[model samples]
Target: MASEESLEESKKKVYRKEQALKRTAESLEDDEEIELPRKRYYRQRAHSNPFSDHELIYPAKPEDMKWSMLYGGSNEAPTVADVGCGFGGLLVSLSPALPKERILGIEIRVQVTQYVLDRIHALRKQNQGKEVDYTNIACLRGNAMKFLPNFFGKGQLKKVFFCFPDPHFKLRKHKARIISPTLLSEYAYCLRPGGIVYTITDVKDLHDWMRSHLEAHPLFERLSSEEEESDECVKIMTTATEEGKKVARNGGSKYIACFRRTENPK
Candidate 1:
């Protein structure tokens, strides 16, 4: 029963965090320009170590999630997920671009997640009653590597973005990289056949590593150059991520590799 008690305590902590988040969003005034969250105030280490949970909240399963608290009006489950969504650049960019689809940004850092939450609330209030009010986009605090399948049902997501992910340079730490053989299976299971997986990174070694793994996965097929160029999501991702912007400012190279989730083998 100790294990069960621990689970209950974790759930309570998560519930309290949710309530605090609600209060923060509710406290925002419907002003001409809702005050934007300051990055300096939401200070967090550049690289997050996912093993550190810090007592955050997540659903036991997808069904138990309270998505309405994360979004304003949308009742639909998120169709797109941006993993390691630092500062939520892609999440904000994709909001108006795909107003019909619910986009969820999953980040592990508590302060970063709070900043994204505040930023989203500000954006919604700023664009209130506009054509695209950003009700379809939201951010959540969770470890995507460990809990993605718990939050996304089978064949639930149509698009998944891994933009400028941590390279995990040390050979011993390669297993910590997000696109490992085992994680790819979970990704494939969550995405429907023909769904797209978009990955980009400035680090060449990490690029090659992710590409090789996805290629080896039986359920994934690499997209063609023409297809990558033509995809709107790919285009947005190239410039929408915070790390992508930093790379551009420093004149670094970015490698992109996209794959299609194919049907499960008979």
Candidate 2:
């Protein structure tokens, strides 16, 4: 009886392993469909450590990056980056507003980034003949925290948006929150003097944390409430992103903190 029971348990374990493998296969199949063109063209890399695979997404130098390929051979480089752009809502809304300025959205998730790419492709096709071409905006899969400087030249960016960023609420995970001292230094390096860093979140603790860090950073100075209110981009950022819309629907309060890159560290 003991030997029979042992055999039965072993069989159950094997069955469970088979079920897990089946689920994993199904997930991979779904991912393949979603990541079609990218899966075919680009080599896949681990999402956790973006810098580990240096050749995956970024060019060696910002100047070496082919903006033309993405923006229809336009010589002008992107002056704005929407970090962690999910579903590309903010980029879509900002495209019409800043008709001339090139904008790039960097997202980490494979399927979400692919969805944004497809969304942009559809929008561009829809408005092919219109005066306002969305060729100014593009999306790419990137880990912004690790590879920000890899993409933008020093003082190349005029605006950086951190709209509804992931709030790493745990005390231990705060370093991953994206607005750290080290990351702020990188942000300051990429942003032109007097350029803006716009941040907003529905999470109050996260908002406070971001504000305090920016305030403490020598290179950044907090924007006055009036100045923030006057900026058109702020308004769009507040209402444009998917997170922003969800916050609005739920009547949740959003905390905004805008900072300017100073000419010299204070």
Candidate 3:
């Protein structure tokens, strides 16, 4: 059993480590911009919040989280988080599928983030007293890589999605790639035992890279092809994601992998 003093020290360590990540990530912001290919994209909705007198189902701290209350009933609702959630596609879609408090959408882009916020607000206004309640989806404009630990405690998040993350194709720019050993550690840290990390990309090379890293990760167990196929929850790479749809329309084949977080090594 961990002593009180040991637990306090652990919390302090977690805070310090998070700060270190922020400092190191600062370097990524200095890269020069280039005229990138203008991929076909959709426009974002305007900004507005529609919730009126909404109460927080759980306290700000993850330690204060109550799973039973968060899910309203005996059904185990997945506290799903869409990391690198761009334009709120997956977040908004999954919101109606589950309880409002259980779905969180996190994105870094300020403009798109505000757009999603407005879109949800519009949704809420449109669905007043309806079965499709939009309050289940909330968008936060912040870096997912750093804010992940701040919002969630160890073993709290159930499903984490990294749908079509920036590949950062160059070898020299691999660190900028979203999937890495360090990032995977943070993903594993947030996930409860048996929680899964799902990733999809149209880039074949990036797909292989993600598979290699996740498979080699100590905290993750690679799901067998048969297991992945059998699990309805872990469905195949789909056009559900905005980027996935774009890639699919372009005749690109999506590659996907799912890894379950096993128990901490003794």
Candidate 4:
């Protein structure tokens, strides 16, 4: 038999989900306005196996993607990517920060992606006709590590972010980590020379692992501490992620490592 506490928690979960469905409906149909999605209602497990197969939508190639559909009639392709953009905290923060550049957040989870999509829709509706209408940021459901090249042309992106990614602490799981040699080469293909990759995490081990991999990759060069402090995207990512804020509240350490994609060798 379940305890009263357990029953109460289950009831709350059902109620919260219903509320989410109602809010989603309002955001879809209403012209005037709608409230932002509460993250609690969109909860999911923190870790997803990047290796798993899931039904996902992606373009065969960069040019085949219908950018205008996501950007609301704008033909401009996204120049920034928030890989593994959990709940889209960075995407919302980066939207107005870089208003002219389109930003895309890719997440693997279904419910979490829906929350971000609805959140962006609500924000866009709220700011309709305003000077900064959030037409610059969008969220999509896909595996960033696998399909980045499928969605972005070579040298098309100027920046990519990996914020507090799954640490994958086990030795066997290192391949699942987002910043590996092969993936870095793929990232280099998508980013123009001099483009940046920003990474922040509360886990020291994962941070070091990512740093080492990027340093070893010929196509990447780590930014100096001075250079890191001066970069606006670096600043945004430090506090713009929900995980970053959680780490701060608990007085945990944050490790940030940024790298520049070098120009192709002759």
Instruction: Give the 10-residue window scoring lowest on summed lDDT in candidate 4.
Output: 15-24
How many steric clashes does model 4 contain?
A: 0
User: How well does each candidate superpose onto the true structure, as a TM-score?
Assistant: 0.88, 0.79, 0.69, 0.90
Q: Tell me the tens digit of each residue's lDDT in model 3 across 144-176.
A: 555567667888788888888887778987776
State which candidate, 3 or 4, has the greater lDDT. Answer: 4
Q: Model 3, stretches more than 4 Å misplaced?
A: 1-78, 230-237
Which candidate model has the greater TM-score, 1 or 2? 1
Which parts of model 1 have CA positions greater than 4 angstroms off?
1-32
lDDT of 1 by residue, 1-266 (tens): 99997877686557546545655666673344556766755666888886665576778888887777777554568999999999999999998788879999998888789889888877877787899888888888888888898899999999999998888899988989999999999999999999999999999999999999999999999999999999999999999988999999999999999999999889
The alpha-carbon RMSD values of the candidates against the true structure, listed in the order shown, are 7.8, 9.5, 16.9, 2.7
Candidate 2 weakest lDDT stretch, 10 residues? 34-43
Tens-digit per-residue lDDT, 109-226, candidate 4: 9879988987897788789889878889998999988999999999999999999999998999999999998999999999999999999999999999999999999999999999
Give per-candidate clash totals. 0, 0, 1, 0
Best by lDDT: 4
lDDT tens readout by residue for model 2, 78-104 = 999999887788999999999978999
TM-score of 2: 0.79
Answer with 2 or 4, whichever has the higher lDDT. 4
